[model samples]
Each structure stands twice: as structure tokens, then as C-alpha cells.
Target: MKLPALLRRRAEPAEVGGVARLDRRTKNLTKRLHPGEVAIIHHSDLDRVSAEALVASGAGVVVNAVRSVSGRYPNLGPSILLEAGIPLIDDVGEDVFTLVTEGDRLVVDGDRLLDTEGAVVVSGTLVTTDVLEEQLEQARAGLSDQIDAFTLNTMTYLREEKELLLEGVGVPEIRTKIDGRHVLIVVRGYNYRGDLDVLRPYISEYKPLLIGVDGGADALLEAGYKPNMIIGDMDSCSDAALQSGAELVVHAYRDGRAPGVERVESLGLSAVVFPVLGTSEDAAMLLADSYGARLLVAVGTHYSLVEFLDKGREGMASTFLTRLRVGSKLVDAKGVSRIYRSQVKGWHLALLVLSGVVALVTALAMTDVGGAVGDLLLARLRDLAYWIKELLT
Candidate 1:
């Protein structure tokens, strides 16, 4: 098969290897790499954050599964890869793993890099001085727009929160009024879905107040749980979920006007709008604290400087301030999947069957099995009939 010109140069290659560092985020996936390790930069969310991080880390090359958005939208990730002098391999497929055996000499042929085993080597790179300067200039040019967008979004969210607080609506507070109660604050991003899956079983045990922030509300509803309250500017939220009996809180700026609040009112849903000076997540945390929550658990919230930057805003100041206001009550759920074990296992099937048998035996002992089973089945049929009737109604 004819290969790209870059790969042709590596027709004769050697072998080398190291720990396989897989980067799903555009942050520096290779920042922690040792001198000779191979960095595999997987485009997890296909965001620029992971790409930027990989470039800053200075890996030898970067194998990307993500299409570079056809070079539009100022993809900092691929730009970083190219400018950092890192070899870029596009769509090398899964077989590329065989060529990477810890420490193999690899050759970069355009978007394909192959090792001695004739497999592709995945690596990443760092942003060199030249690329850094260019990136800075771009950032400087876009700073004003970034700030304006941040301000507008912040104002929208804050107004919603103020209205919520002023209305004295019986919305579930972020913190528990009852001592020892826990509050789970959910956001959508990163490994959020995985984290929520891990935390699902504990929901019933801890009985934490479920508060969904924006898209997090849909996540909760999808997981078969209803949020006690929903907070944010109401962007990226589903209409059905917003009207699912959860109290709505819109965050707006201190100017006392909130467009999000207007929308909430237009929907005929009463919302408490609060004016705050930070991100919607920040406002949510602060409101949770003010409402007397005992403990706050944060899921999928941005934590690092790069992540904050990825939000395309000067979030550091507000995030810092928000943390100070609620740090004592905050517990991050990052990597929670590693810690929280699922209670149900494959072995539970036998127990479930046994329980069913026991119930059947008890029914047989109390009454005739034939009649009991027939009656129980009829009851279920009646329930289904009612559901159908409701649908028609």
C-alpha cells in the first residue's frame, strides 16, 4: 500500500518504548511522562484542551483519532502538535498498538507512524517557544470577546439564582438543613457520566439532595432519578426536565435583570433568580452553602488552570473566589469511579431467582399457585391497560 510521503521516510526504522500514556483530554497528557515514554493522545472529547496539554508536554509525536475539524475553529490542539515539531498521525486505527511495544523505534509517515513490528507509534509534543508566542498573540486578540461572553453568561446565571432566593421557594438547598445530610452537585463534562454511574448506588444510602446544574439535569433524568432543584442560565437544559417538578434557579448579575429568568417565567414556571459574580457552577455552590447544606459534593466541575482556560474565560479569579466561599463544604468527585464500587454483581442473579422462588412458594402455601399466578398476571395486565388508557387520554 502506498503511504504518505512522511511515512515513506521511515521505511527503515528501529525500536523503542515506554509507558503508554493515553490522553483523552486536550490538556498536557504527556506532562507527567518520563524521558522515553510514548504518549498516545486520544481525542476523548475532541476538544482543544487535550491538544494544548499534549503540545505543552513535549512528546515526540501525536497519534490522533479525532478529525481536526478540517482545520477550522482554531484547533489549538493540532496547531500545537504541528508547531511543537511533533509528528501528527491521523486515523491510524487500533492496530497501531501492536507496533508500540513500550520502547520501539517508530517512523512518522505523514499521518501514520509505524514501528519495527510494522505497527504505528503514538506520541505527542510540547509547545515550543515560537508556537507559544503566536498562541499568546491570538489570546490577546480574543481576550475582549472572551471576557464579554463570560460576563454575559455569568449575569444570566446570577439573575436566576437571586430570583430563586428572593422567592423563598422551597427549593432543595445545596447544603442539607438537617445535620449530616449531603448535597450532590452534578455538572456535565469529562468523566462525569462514569462518576455518576459509580455514585448511583450511594444515592439511596446517603440520600443527598440532588441538584443538577444545566446539562446535569438531563443526566440525572436519564439515569432515572429526578433532580430536587435545577440551577444555571437554563441554557443546555431540556424542557421536560426543567418542568419535572424541580425548582429552577437562574443566576444573573447584580443589575437585577435576568433574561434567563424571563424565559423561565415565560414557560409559566416560577423560578428564584439570584445575582452572583462568578460562573454558574460557582453560583450554584455559593447558593448551596447559603441555603445551609451540610456537605457539598461536586461532580464534573473544572479544577485545573488549563481546564479553566479551556472554558475560554478568565475563570481563575471567580473560581478561586468561589472556592474560598465554599471550600470547607466542597468534596470533589473526580476519579470517584475508582473508589465507589457497585453493590450489584453478576452473582446477584441467583439470589434474585431464589427470592422469586421463595415468593412463589409462599404464595403456593397460602393459596393455590395456579390461581395466584393467574391473579398476579391479571393485575399486571390491568396496570398495562391503565397505562394504555392514560396514553389515549
Candidate 2:
């Protein structure tokens, strides 16, 4: 049965089912739930993170607001719920909350479980040992892919400026200043914004050295945070970010060529170029690690093959090397949107009009006898009545 339908037909608290309201970020709320507490998972944007957190928190039944109906494409949400041996009520929508009050009675027939009033009860089992292992494996695999994609995509942009990336600059490598300090590395992407939102409070509390990888400098600025250092090939980074007071480090190839450095200099930004064998993000991490930075937090970093393919990268060697270089100092911010805010861009209309004009001109030039053919067709249409009369006579 559909989740919405099932929720609508749920028995009263005194009859069979118990109710637990779950409308917040699972990452934060999951830790609050006791074992076997019914959880309603909301926040569609962070579906994967929410599912994982809820399952880890040991929720008995996870009723999701955003889910794949009819299993067309298997989502991480339903899979996590199933693996947890938790009954998944899909497509419950908003109305599911209206059916039950804070205290309700509920029972699961598949697992032979029951909950009465505000008390938690389990009959068969909340989650089986085997299912937990399977879920863990799946989650691990998914996380690996996500990281791999992020690494490869970051490399694509680096490779375009390979010559500059390998050249080493003469900046004094301070190896002890950042020791014991939390270092947050920001890379610009959809997930980066969200992760930053969540990390803002933590940043204020911890006061981590904020490092922006290329375009990620703009991300930090947009988040109202000043970056301490900007590292990358310099392409895709905003002009304002370049001008921001952060020290700039351009990733250059080993041959003493620094492409991105020139752009930074052109913007009148002081920078030191470092020739490295890997990606800019990799360079950022390595530089921090080499300099004795304590903890390295990565945001919006790619980690999958598909993501790499989308970025048009060739290999994963650099990412592997960088990860090895950073080791345990890395903490990935894969889903940090539980706290971030962002502005929406409204330039789509202007771009769409420009695209339409370019396409129209290209089509006109490509056709043979384009204008003459169009004129002939118009004349024929105008003489259609004369031809019709002649045919009738």
C-alpha cells in the first residue's frame, strides 16, 4: 500500500500504533530517538544523509516524505529503511502527520511488532543482524563512489592547466602554525552550500582555518565567511574572491609554469604558485598537511566515477595519492545542507534568449537556398485559392 494511504488508515493510539514526529534533519534528530521509536523522515534534499542517519539511530519504522514510488529507481532512502528492517511507508506526504497525535498505537504485521501509547515495544525484531551488514556494505559502496567522482571532477579542471600545476613556487611552507586547529576546505558545488550552512556554527565554535579551493573561494564569500587561503588553478573562481584578502596559492605542474597565477596577478591579488602532481583540492590538503594542519574538513568534494566522467577527467591516481597524503586528517562534508543558506541566480532568461538567437542564425546559414526557398513557399501559399478554383472548374 502507498505510504499516504497506510498513514491515513492508521489505527488510533489506544487501538494499535504509536506516533513519533520526525520533520527535522535526520543527522541532528536521529541521535535523539530511542531504539524502536517510530520516525517520520522529511527534508527531501538530504534524503540519503537522512536515511543513513535514521537507520544508524535505530528507528523502528521510517515514514519518508520524499521517496521513489513503485521502485522505478531504487533510492538510498527506501534501501536504508529496508536494510534497517524498518517498515518503509513511502509517499506519506504532509497528511501523514495529521492522522496521529503525539501518542498513538501502531503495529507492524511483517515483523510482528506493536507499539502502545507513548511506550516503545518490539515483537519480532527491529533490525536483523544480516540486514544491518548488508546496509553497511551498501552505504560504504555508495560513499566510495561519491568520493571518487568528486576527486576526478576536481582533477579535470586541474589538468586543463597541467603545465602551471607542476611548477613549484617559493612560498615559505609554515609547518607548525595550523597544528591542532580544525581546517575547513570548501569546494563549490550543490552539496558545498548545504554543508557550509551546517558547519557555520561549528566554524564559529572551532574557528577552523577556512581554505577555499579555486572557485570555492566564492562559496566562502557567499556564506559570509572570509577564507584564509585560496588554492587552485584559478579558473572558475570569481574576481571578487580573488581580490578578497586571502593568500592565493596556484597549483602548477612540475615544469615551473603557473597559468592560474597569472590570472590572480592580473586581478592584482598577491599569490604564490605551487607545482603539484595532483588536483587543486589535493594540493590544498597536502599543503595543509605538510604544514601540520590538524583536521582537514572537505565540503562538496566529488567521489565517484560518474562524477569524474561528468567532469571529463582521465584517471583517479591523483585523488588516491592526495587521500593517502592526508590520511586520517580528513573529514568529508558530504551532506552539510542541514544549516547552509544560498542565493538563487536569475540569469537563465538572458542566457536562454542568447542561445535561441545563436541557434536560429546557425540554422539559417546551414540550409541551401534558405531565403529563396522561404520566399517561394510564401508565394505558393498566397496562390492556393487560384489553384483551388481552377481544380473545381
Candidate 3:
């Protein structure tokens, strides 16, 4: 069982060199990470979504200030980096952040990070597939504890927000007509770009009310669709997205304290405040449900248990309850894309036209009057051809 897996470990190079792009926030760091640049991040227990972002950024090497795995329920980020053929140096300590400056060309030689002066700045574990698998196995044994944490968090959330969850009391009124329309909620989660690409057909057909959650608003823009509404804590999305004329719904704390409100106001823009206990994704869903959306199609949102945990949030508990609240009205984009056959295609139209032409010809050939008309037409075609031949000669 282990032999093939061991053999599947990719051949790693001894050294890699690139310009260093340093940021503690992996999300912000990814935006600036150019191809062949070294990304310096302090992220621990790196989640799948963030890892996917790093991979997509085309970072040549990653140097982390903390353990990427950290025995946190087998987070897939480190493994994803290694599988993408990008070297990950794990746990070089917080001192690396102080030692390394932005745009400094650095070299990863085995386990050591070297600066432009060829001096070793930090030494950390070069994470390989073997290390990743072993750490993941150890992390798997602690999943029961994680589940217990989730349960506790869920109960706490339910106790605190029961009225909002059950009665729909605090959901804000929006001018956007969500009632009797399909609503598409987009989140910047795992395989978001791919999900958006696959959903293009559905998006084009139904023209769902697009609700972008934070960075997901920027995602919608990148996918060439303007969001009808942008919802989140307001940190991840770009300023351009905020100014795109989409209705902004800022997710705030239960105390009515909204950090996004300040940012939106700073931009000379207005937004509706949604004071909710759950995540922005949950807030978007609840808002749609409250406004009487017919069907909710979720794109790039976390669905599986592993995914919830991978987000590194105890607050995913609210998402669990939120799903239960939404019930049958909610649908995954992947599921919809799989089951919903495209209603029309170029080939289908072409086939329809060809069938009509064939039916017309068959009808024309099968009747006596049609046969006489066909003979006369053929004689006229022959006479026209002879005239064309004479002209050519």
C-alpha cells in the first residue's frame, strides 16, 4: 500500500531562487505573488482554500513562519504546495519575518533559506510528501476532538441567535428583488474559479441574483460578471468591486459593531449593515432566504465536514445551522452543474434546422404536385447552368 505512494513522491530540486513576497495574511500575499516569486507567510494549519490560492498564484517557493500542518485535522495546504512542485519550508520561526524584507531575492537550498548575500537567513523543515502523509495521519486521530469543538460552538451559536435563526427578525431589507428569483451566492473557497467556469451556462440562462461574499465579489468580477450584491466583513474584496454599483451588505458583530462600515464609508459608498453571528457566507444565505429567494445555488462555498474544519473557524457552526435552516431550497453549484442539462446548444439548433429542411424536402418529394414542381425546378437549374457555361466559354 505504501510502496506506490512512496514512489509517487515527486523528485524535488535541491535549490530554488525567486524574489521574496512577504505578508502575514496569505490572502493579501497571494494577490501580489507573481510567478517565480517566493511567498513568505506566517499561516499555520494552512487550509485547502488558501492553499489553492497560493498554488494559483504560481509561487515558486513558500517559506512559512509556522507549522503548515500543526496537527490540525490534516489540513491539505502543505500537501497541495508540495504536489504542485512548489517547495514549502515549514516553521522557520517568527524571526524569519524580521530577517527577510520584501522584494529581496532569496534562495531555498534544501532546508535553508539564503538571502541575496548568500548568507543563511533561516533553516526550516523542507516538507515532502512523506512528512505530509505522516503529519496527516497523526492529525486524523484528533478529528473527534475537533468535532466536539464544532458541536459546542454550534450549540453556543444556536443559544445566542435562536430568534434570528428561527424568526428572521434582524435580516435587513434590500431594494434588490430576490423574491421569485434564483440567487447565486459566491464564496472564494476551494476550486472557486473552476466552479464559476462550470456555472457559466446556468448563470447565463437563469441570470441568478449574484451575491458575492467579500473576496468573492472580486472573484465574480474576474469571472466577468458583476455582482448584484456584495456581502462580507469587507477586508478581502478590492475597492473597484465596492465601487461597481453592487449593493453592499456589511457583515457585523452581534453588538452592531461593523468594521466594514468604516471602509465602505471611506470610499464614499453606502452599504446595508447585516448584524449576524455567523460567517459572511451564512449571512448571504440567510439574507436570500429572508427575502424569499426561490432557489439558492452556492458557488465556492464550503460543504463537507473537512472543508468546514479546513477553514480554521469555530464559527463554521453557524454555517451548519444556517444550512439546516435553508433546507431544500439550497443547492450546491457542482450538483446543479452536474444534473442540470444545458437546455440549448449550437449543435441542437443546427440539428433542429437540418431536420426541418429534411422534412420539407421529404414532403416536397412525396407528393404529385411537389414532384411536378421539382421537375420544373431541375429543368430551370439545368437551363441556368447551360447559360452560365456559355457565358464562361
Write down the TM-score of every candidate: 0.49, 0.44, 0.85
Per-residue lDDT value at 280 in model 3: 97
Best by lDDT: 3
Deviating ranges (above 4 Å) for candidate 2: 1-176, 338-393
Q: By TM-score, how accurate is candidate 2? A: 0.44
Q: List model 3 lDDT by residue over 203-317, tens digit each.
A: 8999999999999999999999999999999999999999999999999999999999999999999999999999999999999998899999998898888889898888998
Model 2, 1-393: lDDT tens digits are: 122333333332222234574554454466476667677655442344456657767776765554422222122454445544556554545554555444455655443334444332333322333433344455445655655655665567456534433432332354236767888988774367678887877898999998899878988998999888889888767788888788888888767688997887787667777876566777788777767678999997765443333232344446655665578989888765654444445577778889999898678657877666767878998799789999999
Residue 272 CA displacement from its true place in model 3, Å: 1.2
Model 1: residue 256 alpha-carbon error in angstroms: 2.6
Candidate 1, residue 216: CA error in Å? Answer: 1.1
Query: Between which residue pairs do clashes occur in model 3?
Result: none
User: lDDT of each model, Cα atoms only?
Assistant: 0.62, 0.62, 0.90
TM-score of 3: 0.85
